[model samples]
Target: MAHQTPDLIVSRRYLRLDCLCLLLLMLSACSSSDQIEQQSRTVASASQTVLMALDAWAAGAAPTAYTVDTLQSIGKTLADTGAQIRSAETSEPTEQASLTKAVNDLSVAVTRAEAGLQADDRLKVQDAQQDLRLASRALATAYAKYFAPKP
Candidate 1:
């Protein structure tokens, strides 16, 4: 067999190194994708919980207009959901910020409604309800935009 040139031996080593690097990069990308998917699923589940709580409150099932306990329960749910959104590990910082803001706003609105219930103020509770609904819609839009599949 002919002797291999020094340059050829170096080129072969470089090719192998490149192949190994490419495989490692591919594996890292897959891991990152899996992490993102898990984060999205967690956010989705929290969003669903908040939405269900909002629906119940809006349907008069919580007696927010009269009972303090129901108002507290709804407020707690909103706050918990907001906390979850804030703590979620999302790849997109801007989207995460917007979602956190929307969720926090809803939580604050619910707290205001709870205060209104405690004070027996119908107008205050109604206004807070409207704010909560608007916040919820904003959050839903953000969630859809962030989690939608790429084209």
Candidate 2:
């Protein structure tokens, strides 16, 4: 049996500690990647919902021909999508906040459109439509900022 020197014992302990740290780092990185992937899927799902609602609204046989019920339904869809976006977890706090704000703005615009439909006010509806377009743009920007491929 050989007696190990103090330096050898210290070196072995240091190597073990280094290995532990590396393992923890790898695990954290994998967790982060999984989180980002989940967030991307959530954003894609919400974006699809918004786009579908927009398409349905635009598919009316005639321009400015959406019924009150249709407007209400679209508004509800927008609100629900916003809720989904809000519930998604993101690695970027700033981007998450921006996306949340954009989604909330879209929901508000849709609500206004629904109100306009209920009031039979074409001007108000048009204004809300414009706001919706802007909100959509903002949301797209935020989504890209957070979910864009890293070079």
Candidate 3:
């Protein structure tokens, strides 16, 4: 088993604490409607990529470093989406607040998945995968009405 050094413990705690504080940014009920729609779609698409990457790693189809890189790459997508959410104007403050929570939940799930890999804990990684699945569903269910239909 890998050693749980103090640095590892501290990093884990800090990452989790940061996760709890995650929040989404911008949304406007009127002019920014298109932007919100795009952001939600992006989140959904990026989510699938991350989940698939994690699954590949778990199934031994991918190496740890590759999986970690993929997770980090997708994690940046979440971060960008969150930033866009934070910066946009909102005609629906209540809806924005709800989206913020959903986005934050997804952000946390991503971090947890990466953490699990760092710790070399398959159980934790599995748990993170479940978290990602639930979080993704929550994000879609809570805000699907706002997205534009695909052609």
Among these predicted structures, which one has the highest TM-score?
3
Looking at model 2, which ten-residue stretch has the lowest summed lDDT? 61-70
- RMSD, each candidate, Å? 5.4, 5.4, 21.3
Global lDDT of model 3: 0.80
Candidate lDDT scores, in order, read 0.66, 0.66, 0.80
What is the model-wide C-alpha lDDT for candidate 1?
0.66
Going through the candidates in order, what is the number of backbone clashes in each?
0, 0, 12
Q: Residue by residue across 1-151, what tens digits does model 2's lDDT show?
A: 2899999999999999999999988787667556654554554454455445545554653334445555566556556655655665445778777877887787787778767766767687678778877887887788788776767
Q: Rank the candidates by TM-score, best first.
A: 3, 1, 2
Clashing pairs in 1: none
* Model 3 stretches astray by more than 4 angstroms: 1-31, 145-151
* Tens-digit per-residue lDDT, 54-145, candidate 3: 99998999999998988899889899897887677866656666666777888888889999999999999999899889988888876864
Off by over 4 Å in 2: 1-66
